[model samples]
Target: MNWTLEVVVVPVSDVDRAKEFYAGRLGFAVDHDTDLGGAGRIVQLTPPGSGCSIVLGRGVVPEMPPGSLKGLQLVVADLEKARAELVERGAEVSEIQVVGQNPRPVPHPLDNVGFVFFRDPDGNEWAVQQISARG
Candidate 1:
C-alpha cells in the first residue's frame, strides 16, 4: 500500500487573514477558498513543489481544540541563507537548534538540518527549516 499525505487542516480564527499570511508572506498558492454549506469556510493553499497542502477554514466537526498545535516545520536548501531570507522577509525567525535526547550525537540535528521557529499574527507557531539535501 502506498499512502500519500495530501493535506493538513490548519485551524484559524479568520480564514482571510490566514490566507493572506500563507499566500502573501509564506508564498503559498491558493488552491481553494469557499464556504462549506452550513459548516463554515474553507481555504486551501499549496506549497511550491510539494504534494501536500494546508487548509485554513471553519466549522470543522469537533473543531480543533485550542492549544494543541505546537508549531509548523519547513525544509529549505541552505540553512543560514534560508534563515536570513526569512528574516529579511520580515519573519521573526529564531535561532537554529538540533533535536535529540541522548548524548550519542548530543543532538540528532534533524538529519543534520537547521531549524528556526516563528509565529503567525495569530500567535500560531511556525517554523522554517533547512536541510543540506533531500532525496
Candidate 2:
C-alpha cells in the first residue's frame, strides 16, 4: 500500500475569491469548479508540477476558521526565481530568508536554507523553500 497526499482542503470565507487568488494570482491551475445543486460548490486547484491539489468549497467541506491553516510548505529549485514569479503574479511574498545552517554547501549558499513565505486571501500561510538537490 502507498500513502499519498492527493488533496488538501483549504478553508476560505469566499470560495470564488479564494479561487481567483489561487488560480489568478498564485497561478494554480483550476482543476474543476463544480456546483452540487443545492448541496454546495467545490473548486479544486493544483500548483504547477504538483500532484497534490487544494480544495476550496462552500457547504461541501470541513468547517474551520478561515485563515487558521498555516505552515503549508512548498519546495522549489530556485528560491529567488520562485519569489520573483510569485511577486510577478501579484502575490505579496516575503523576502527570501536564510534560516538555519546548511548541512552541505551547494552552488548557491541559499540552497536548503533559503525560504519565502506568503499568505492567501484567507490568510492561509505557505512557505516556499529552495532545495535544488536533495541528499
Candidate 3:
C-alpha cells in the first residue's frame, strides 16, 4: 500500500484569477476546468514534471478561508533559474536566502539551505527550495 499525495485543495477567492496566476504566470499546466453546474466548479493544475496536482474550486471543496494557507513548498534543481523564470513571469518572489543549516552534505552550498518565497493572488504563500541532487 502506498500513501500518495495526489492533490491539494487550494482555497481561493476568485477561481479565474487564481487559474491565470498558476497556469499563465507560474507555468503550471491546466489539467482540467470542470463546471459542476449547481454544485460548483473545479480547476486542476499541475506543475511541470510534478506528480502532485493542486485543485481550485468554488463550493465543491472543503471550507477554508481564502489566503489562509501558507508554507506550501516546492523543490527545484536550480534556484537561480527558477527564481529568474518566476520574476520574468511577473511573480513577486523573494530573494534567495539561506534559511537554515543543511542537515547533510550537498553538492552546492545553497542546496537544502537556499530558498525563495512567493504568494498567489489571494496571498496563499509558497516557498521554493534548491535541492540540486537528491540522495
The best candidate in terms of TM-score: 3
Q: How many clashing pairs per prediction, in order?
A: 0, 0, 0
Q: What is the per-residue lDDT of model 1 for residues 51-126, given as tens digits with 9 covering 90 to 100?
A: 8888888786247753245666767666677667677767777887765443334122554445788876666777
**Ranking of candidates on TM-score, top first:** 3, 2, 1
* Candidate 2 C-alpha lDDT tens digits along 24-83: 998899999999999999999999989999999989899999999998888899899999
Per-residue CA lDDT of model 3 for 1-106, tens digit only, reads 9989899999999999999999999999999999999999999999998899999999898888999889889899999999999999999999999987888878
Comparing 1 and 3 by TM-score, which wins? Answer: 3
lDDT of 1: 0.71
Backbone clashes in model 2, listed as residue pairs:
none
lDDT (Cα atoms) of all candidates against the true structure: 0.71, 0.93, 0.95
Candidate 3: where are CA atoms >4 Å away? none
Which candidate do you rate higher for lDDT, 1 or 2?
A: 2
Off by over 4 Å in 1: 99-111
Candidate 1 local Cα displacement, residue 1, angstroms? 2.3
RMSD of every candidate to native, in Å, equals 3.7, 1.0, 0.9
Cα displacement (Å) at residue 51, model 3: 0.4
